[model samples]
Target: MSLFQNLKSELIRKPNSGKHLPFVDGLRFLAIVPVIFQHANERLFKYGNLPELKGWEEQVSFLISRGTIGVFIFFAISGFILSLPFSRENSKLNYKTYLKRRWQRIEPPFIFWMTCCALILLVMQAYPIGELLWHYLATVTYTHQLFYQEYSIINPVAWSLEVEIQFYLLAPFFAFAYFQVRSLAKRRSLLIAGIFGWILLQHGMGWHLQPWKATLLGQLPHFLVGVLAADLYQKPVKWIRDFRFWDLVFSLLLLTLAYTWTEELGKTFLFELSLLGLLLSAIYGRYTSRILSLSWISIIGGMCYTLYLMHLPLLEGYYSFIARFGQWSGYIGQLSISLIIVLPIIFLCSVIAFRWIEQPFMKKKDQKSLRSNPIGKQVLSKA
Candidate 1:
């Protein structure tokens, strides 16, 4: 291969979402996989021709649906990733530039996918343009939940992105409060409180409430946990040590639990604590960290945004197309078949978006510290 092609080929595996760093990308990988599973699992019952499940099948289906813990993981990862810049010593945020850069990096691909998905829907489903247009506008503005108190009409998964954007706008302020206290004990104590505080409030106020569940207040605990992780990640973290197999086991156990959990808005105190352990293992566990840091794995994890944004739309197309072939019965066969068919398509499309679309934004140098960078002011100099 030519040198330019070689460079691009290698770079394509490096996800630019949060520094193209293995540790964060690995976590991203962890976060995105379950989300895909959550959706796939949900779709199996819908498109899989299975009757309302009974016995263990019904119970298992409900538990498998808990793959949404990945979304909460993403929230924590965002908190951890964004905290790097603002959490650095003597840090001061350039509010306007920060917001601008965030938009520039994230908005184009988001808009592209949204527009494409909307157009495809219009053409295929033949929804009235007036209704679709209004929903499209609302989705674009991230205000769909407020109007409809539900997932985006254009992109069902965009509800999480809406929550993400809410966190993004407020992250710096949260950081300000976090970093203000000079005492480490006091600062960490504050984070712990914030974490539980939000969880308690959500559960206390009833997370089942429609519009409120869609907001940041519902997910703030997860973000706070991420902030706590950032603080630990920036140093050797005196308290954190690889417990060899135990730490690895700890991570796996929590992951299994997260996959099976069916409960609150996914920002509970135990969940937040579990995120810290889960992420810390990925960051610090000798065995766990090595596996997570594998080049290919982290590379795929980095492209999670594309996978996330495009998965549902792609699935819509896939199921429709596959319906022509035949339908599969039994949840087991359906799950396996859907994943085998759908995952490859999602990855292929994500690679294209990552290399051509997202990477260009990363090339626009900013004063942001990367997770891949050694905990400091190491700017990503675009080649």
Candidate 2:
């Protein structure tokens, strides 16, 4: 490759490290970008001098807030990706290797960043070094919820990561019956029952905060939806085929319904159903799938773990630098500034982290690469 080609290749995305799926990474890109903006919008409001929303801007802000659905998107993707090995016939599941790979893939970047965060806080005297160290240890263990009964004092985002760990540990068993059973109707009926079963259990007993939202049980349906998507993607039904533009349009409608339900219909199994339809439509739609599978979009999606780990801290830490110019437009203007200015910085910094901190831990192949029953990823009230 020539010089420009070399740099471009390196900059665009890393190498394949496993069984690759281009559109899924594209799906991740679609999911994560909104999450970055969601935080940027929140920061511009809470910490910046942006003027109040006028007219339809309030509606826009409401839409932006819903971007945290990226968290659940990640959950679904994790379910889809991790379930892949088991979803294949005659595929053997090795318990130890599966456990080890999950640890190796995500743990280092998380630990490095959290350590950096803890050291930064200690150096700044935000907390006593001893106390900070104690919290740091708790955060890495994915037990900060139990230790603090709150979001990690170290890194708030680590909460969802804990649920990722839980899902990682549990995914094999969840995926087994779905793929193992030869009878589609029998397996799918059971899957549907399991999803609503969790919902009904929550509805009947009432939900609790503290540790409950931080665990995998809180968001199990979304992950199950991903598993369902994997099943359908692998063994698609007779009528379930591509419709190109129509499929994309249908996905948009499903997304809109899913978005509006963010508040009132938030915890129901119905929400996961919408997400399922969205995933299937996006995948089976020929044009939508092609667009999602494009080199650039999928590559960015491929690096989402680094983005998720770093974006919030970067926004929170650096907002003051940009907040000075926050009064320019209304909410739209502040948001525009973030999209134009802040997002690039987040990406640039994250690319470095992806190249060094994350890629080193990736499988030898450099390819690409949530919560509820997991942490909801609502911006933390405090450390």
Best-fitting candidate, measured by lDDT? 1
TM-score of each: 0.87, 0.88
Local distance difference test, candidate 1:
0.72
- The lDDT, on a scale of 0 to 1, for candidate 2 is 0.71
Write candidate 1's Cα lDDT for 246-292 as tens digits: 35465665665565344454534456667788877887777777787
lDDT of 2 by residue, 102-138 (tens): 6666777888998888887888798887888889999
The models' CA-based lDDT, in order, is 0.72, 0.71
